[model samples]
Target: MKKLLLAGVTIAMMATPAIAQTYKFAVVPKAMNNPFFDVARDGCLKRAKELGNVECIYKGPIEHEPATQAQIIQDFITQKVDGLAISVADVASMTKSIEAATAAGIPVITFDADAPGSKRIAYIGTNNKDFGLALGKQLLQLRPEGGKYAMVSGGPGAKNLAERVDGVREALKGSKWVEVQGSPTFCNDDSTLAVQQMSDLRTATPDLAAIVPVGGWPMFAPEGFKAFVNKNKKDIDSGKLTLVVADTLKMQLELLRDGYSNALTGQRPFEMGEKSMDTLLAIKKGQKVPEVIYTGLDLVTKDNVAQLLK
Candidate 1:
């Protein structure tokens, strides 16, 4: 009996730390193949290593959609994840699943995009309004004489992109010369596809003064928009089309420097991952985190582009 009790105690001791072992967190983006979210995933993984024993799982659909994100969010809940995050592709479509995750007691942080009314605890991404306002301010600087400019973006239903697109329009409102003429084209987060779409739009509009690709991915670099520019470099050079990208993607900086992008609006990818882990660890440690943590953004221009780019 004495030996058995000692054996039982030993087993308990072994089980304690195992039970206390760090749990899994999930990072779900709009799509599994997107290079943009992969950067954020890269940051999350890098930071996950520093935390030791904590695991960060990344999953998403083939295409960027709210339903797929919701499904991934539900899977996290079913798997009993410690935390979950999403760069919402569609806001309204994700509401129920986000609520489901909340019901399961797993806190969720929205990245890249957000659902303002959802049960999500916080967002760890660019400030959309600031992104918009900054773009507005930048547009005036770029074309002080303000002429007809068109906007290209992702889905019209996308919350974050819409904010930036709207902000650009608002900024150009005061400039009588800067008319936003062309119909807004969708970027869909695929550089190749975006290029093709932009090319078609450019072909249709005879006087598309400037192209504003709001946010990361398509607008960030011309190579990403090559479907249009690759065939018409002369047009881009002749001043018929000037491309304005949203955020600076690290790997795409070379393309930007090579003249594919006029400038890029940059977001803090590494810090986003680090901050996200910090938030989860804080919650695990019985600490309270804020409902909103606004990770700001910056603009990258030809002048100081090499500073961070290199």
Candidate 2:
């Protein structure tokens, strides 16, 4: 009887399955304070929960600072995270850090903004140039006659925003629209500065025909943007000034409905966050993944703003 009991215990031990290994992935955004990245953080956490044995560590600088972001990546490396996903603030700096992380046997990927030169396994975000083209096309549709325009952007070093700006320029090629001198005033991810820049640009170029913000920096501060629009209501209503910004955040959509903006081109940060984890997991398993995974874009205008809000 003792032998039979021992034999049964051994069989039970053999039948039990082994516990799966838990993967710790760190999702680093450009700025933790930005609402856009907040959505991405939510997605990362949601996917991590759904994929049991996966832990998502989301961390980044409070503001958009390349040096600070680089330091954060270094810290993650020291912590020996299993994988890394970054929304690069500066391509050059992030490339070096990503290479270091890869050399340490950790897989790395980029999302939202990419550092193509880096050793990252894949890029999961929008086709920024295409996004820019869409913005340009939208502006053209709004003001076909063409006029002097300026672009507002966050962090001048951001590759994604630069691509969008280039795309806007490419689409406006041969059109009546001309970019204003010293255009694309950089806000460095400061919403308040973004509003001030826009106001200043308008003041400097009194006849500035249109304004395109590759990212919705100003609209992040709803009240400030509203004030800016109200101050310029005369020009906006008379069709003397046109506003075409990026991102379809709730407040931005509201501003669009209120006639503060003419058009909006948005990106899917949530999807970017979710896919960043999926791609990193595949990399860890030695599975093949695309070099570029475009999450896609959303073109919002007066006609469809209502539907999107719903």
**What TM-scores do the predictions have?**
0.87, 0.95
Determine the C-alpha RMSD for candidate 2 after optimal superposition of all C-alphas: 2.4
Which 10-residue window of candidate 2 scores lowest in summed lDDT? Answer: 1-10
Residues 1-310 of candidate 2: C-alpha lDDT, one tens digit per residue: 1222564563323445788988999999999878999989899999999998899999999999999999999999999999999999998999999999999999999999999978998999999999999999999999999999999988878899999999999999999999999889999888999999999999999999999988988999889999999999999999999999999988889899988899999999889889988888888888999999999999999999999999
For candidate 1, the TM-score is: 0.87
Q: How many clashing pairs per prediction, in order?
A: 6, 0
lDDT by residue (tens digit), candidate 1, 75-104: 678889998877788888777778888888
Worst 10 residues of 1 by lDDT: 10-19
- The prediction achieving the highest lDDT against the true structure is 2
Candidate 1 stretches with Cα past 4 Å from truth are 1-20, 177-182, 219-227
**Full-model lDDT for every candidate:** 0.73, 0.92
Over 4 Å off, model 2 = 1-14
